[model samples]
Target: MSENFDLIAVSPHPDDAEIGCGGTLALLSEMGYRIAIVDLTNGEPTPFNDDPQVRLNEASKAAKILGIERVTLDLPNRKLLDSIEARMILAKELRRMRPKIVIGMQGMTPRASPDHYQSQLIFDAAVFYSRLSKWEDIFDGLEPWRIENVFYYYTARELLTQSQPLQFTVDISTHFETKKSALLAYKSQFRAHPSYNPPIIDWIEGMGRYFGSLTGCKYAEIFYGSNIMTMNLFKHILD
Candidate 1:
């Protein structure tokens, strides 16, 4: 768990990461931490032009806006299966990246989306496999890697129901707008559809503003973890 990465966010689909923690990611990147986003699925069933190349281009542009690196796993979106094969693939990625903090949607419940469960499986495998020695074979015999902490952001489930309080909330007063702007890049996913009411873009933006108000910021993101995140108290908290 000694490897240092500012943050590694795993998403079930292309836009899940941004919708959940875009504000936090923007703030973290500004603070000089190396950031990475991994999209576990290719999101084929999404209401787009049905071209993988187009989605890839959109994702890349969005990553550029946030100043973070992006990686797509090409996993099937609606049909994500958390099998042993899937875990091994994610395990290899974790070992290669060696992130300090891992964040994702807690696959705690059977959600309507297969993407959710798929992400949960990846997160589950990543947490432990990243630290194991034998898993090195999964990543071309590379050295084992362990992240310092794991935090699950509130996306589908409420944080308090499953985990303790987050060590702290990111004050996204400055980055919230930028984060929203980045999210707008995925126009294909958020447009008003006949079946999908409550357009996602509107909902996500409102959630950011609402969260930000809690910490005196115009917009913000929330994260929760089971472990205590220690700080210098006086210095880190004040700063």
Candidate 2:
């Protein structure tokens, strides 16, 4: 599996990438870019699910719906940490995949699992480690690969107005249903109990519409990046 990817989204859990950026990923996949999701953990031991494999099944279904691939690491769920081990594992995957663009979940969710925050830290380091030349010996002899960009996606856990200076929204009006269907595949999570999940559908739709309004689209997904964007011409910006 030494093939390269156009984009790889790193997530703390299975349903995270779906919730945060499935629409945008689906759109990119439809555009003929090879997209994949690298799940840091399988997101097991939740109150709703018993079998660990169930999450993987749901994650696969979601990936199929998005037309992308899924890779789950054997990292600790719920107890995930941003340690050197975690960084190295993810960096090795990044080197193997050689994705041009890397996406990760952003923001801290104190009310939710602590893995979200640590996942961000791990992602930050993994992207950095993936580009380190001399450290290839530690990664099973995989060659160093420099990712062109690192972007971040977020869910309702973060504020509506992102503080990041380099932020933009992707129009997902045509793929909004695709995103919703992918999220719904996780029956063990959203449909575990109607009262357990916080109206996830509404939350998704609201965020989509809110960002869409900002970008003059029907539905959208916002992303934050570390790079400063440059426009070559006004026509591209106008379009």
Candidate 3:
């Protein structure tokens, strides 16, 4: 929380944001937008990753690659629960950051990780609770703030067979390489066991290209929103 940010991306693990929306973040950072990531967990104690500090270092490198600030909460990995305590902690961070746009996990994963859905629930609750004037006593001395927009990014382990339509697609052809670099920063997760893991980098790049083709771009990232966004017809729709 150094200064107010234009956007904040909430992630379940250290590399989740980079895997899902790194290109969008890199593009925004190049446009001089202040972007930050709030990681729900340190993403450690896995078969390959033992030290949490190593993961933090990797996350820091990824954040630097994307030119964004990163913060990690002390939540348990693989066991994140959607509780009031969790919501309040996230709400305090949201109040401190005061981002206009909030991006979080889609939470519609076919994977068995409950942390994904819990992260989504926490983001939903924190957004609403951060605007509560009555919670002044709980969230330090920060003022109440309401987010302008809420969006969801994809980070499922497997390719989705069916899903809801994307609200929008961001053309990230120019920034796709940057996104790859950020993803590569997590060596412990993706590159540690090349033989055991599928070609994750290739899959990520292919996914971007596939989404890009849908929007007539070379590379892109898809996003979903529950609420309709009002836009200027002449400025955006036509142009």
Candidate 4:
């Protein structure tokens, strides 16, 4: 409906995208993709932060560090829901941006904010609502734009599920430091207190290396999708 983006990563909150798939975003940006991150909420009223604008400023800095565009929606932060209103609001953004691919924050983080799960539902519904036929009135008269690919990125603390969908890995060995820098940009979330920040940063490193080992790489991020991916293995295997 408006500017076209090659890829869009939908985050439930400001730092969600960075923690989930920042390295992939950096890699994609370096490979010349027009990428944008759409944050469903500005992530406010946290234990560490009192001002909501600080979260927005941090998101902007993270986006800059990753070398990508960022957008913050007016949706509720902690109390986010997958209601019809939320669906329409996110669908409007999808219609406006018209991205070919969308990577959504996936899985339920019960130990963390429940907004993560609701955000996943909202992301799923909005992607469907965005491509509906003759629903121009619902989407502010914007034309229906079908997203070609929909994938999900794992969150920080997600519930383990036996029904995990088809999964793949994106090698981020080269851009992993960029990802760390982007995530660290959110100082409010990763403050340099004696007990808070160090372990989290170490976890990030361990997680990336673990996932990368799955694909025989030094560092990588995992992605999940409902659709079957077609690929020729011979093309990637260099003797």
Top lDDT prediction, candidate number: 2
Candidate 3 residue-wise lDDT, 20-111, digit = tens: 88998898888788899999988777678888888899999999999999999998888898999999998999999888788998665655
Per-candidate TM equals 0.85, 0.94, 0.91, 0.92
| Candidate 4 lDDT tens digits, 39-135 | 9988887777788888788889999999899999989988999999999998999999988789998888978889999999999999999999999
lDDT of 1 by residue, 1-239 (tens): 23345678998877778877877787778777788898888676765457777777778877888888888997777888888777777777787787777788764545447568667777888677768886555568867877656777666443245445544556667887777777777655554353564466567667877777777867767766666654222124224
The candidate that wins on TM-score is 2
What lDDT score is found at residue 197 in candidate 2? 83
Q: What is the lDDT of residue 150 in candidate 4?
A: 89
List clashing residue pairs in candidate 2. Answer: none
- Model 1: runs farther than 4 Å from truth? 1-4, 108-112, 156-167, 192-197, 229-239
Candidate 4 displacement at residue 9 in angstroms: 0.7
Off by over 4 Å in 3: 156-166, 229-239
lDDT of each: 0.71, 0.88, 0.83, 0.84
Better of 1 and 2 by TM-score: 2
lDDT by residue for model 2 (156-193), tens:
78544446888788888999999999999999999889
Global fold similarity of model 1 (TM-score) = 0.85
CA shift of 1, model 1, Å: 19
Q: Candidate 4 deviates by what RMSD?
A: 3.5
Q: Which pairs clash inside model 1?
A: 5-100
Backbone Cα, N, C clashes tallied per candidate = 1, 0, 0, 0
